[model samples]
Target: MKIQVLFFGITTDLVGSSTLELNIVDVATVADFKKSLKEKYHQLENLNSYAIAVNESYAADNLLLKESDVVAVIPPVSGG
Candidate 1:
């Protein structure tokens, strides 16, 4: 399955791209996708934490992903 991934804030810098079209195994879960990303982009593992949003909504690790799903990687934010 293919999906669109969006990177935000520090994530974009880490990945070197604001967006990517990736091909993943069918019926992969959010956790699986995340693992794949970390493997492809080792820099991603440097982040303390990040959130995964599917179709504009925060998704859990167990959330199943589908073809063409829009996944966003939002790194932790802090503002004073």
Candidate 2:
């Protein structure tokens, strides 16, 4: 399956791109995608927490991903 990935905040800095096209095994879950990303982007492993949004909604680790899904990597934000 192929999905479009959008990067925001520090995630774009780590990935060096705001958008990426990724290929994943058929019927994969968000956790699977994260594992693949962690392998390719070692810096991602350093994050204390990671958030994935599928089709504009925050997704869980077990959320299944489809070929047409739009995944976004939303970096953590802090405000005073």
Candidate 3:
């Protein structure tokens, strides 16, 4: 299945792109997608934590992804 991934904040720097069209095995879960991303982009593993949002809503690791789903990688935010 194919999904559109959006990178926010520092994630964009880590992935080297604000958006990506990626392919994954059918019925892949959010956790699976995160693992695949960490494998493909090792820099992503450097983050302390991040959130995965599917179709504008925060998604759990078990959420099953669907073709053409829009996923967003939102890195932790820090400010004074």
Best by lDDT: 1
Of candidates 3 and 1, the better by TM-score: 1
Off by over 4 Å in 2: none
**Model 2: per-residue lDDT, tens digit, 9-65?**
998999899999998999899999999998999988778887999999999999999
As for lDDT, the candidate ahead, 2 or 3, is 3
Which candidate's TM-score is highest? Answer: 1
Clashes by residue pair, model 2:
none
* Tens digits of lDDT, candidate 1, 1-80: 99999999999999999999999999899999999999999999999889999999999999999999999999999999
Better-scoring candidate (TM-score), 2 or 3: 3
> Cα lDDT for residue 54, model 3?
99
Models ranked on lDDT:
1, 3, 2
lDDT of 3 by residue, 5-66 (tens): 99999999988999999999997999999999999999998998999999999999999999
TM-scores, each model vs. reference:
0.98, 0.95, 0.97
What is the C-alpha local distance difference test score of each model? 0.97, 0.92, 0.96
Looking at model 2, report the run of 10 residues with the lowest lDDT sum. Answer: 41-50
| Positional deviation of residue 17's Cα in model 3 after best superposition, in angstroms | 0.4
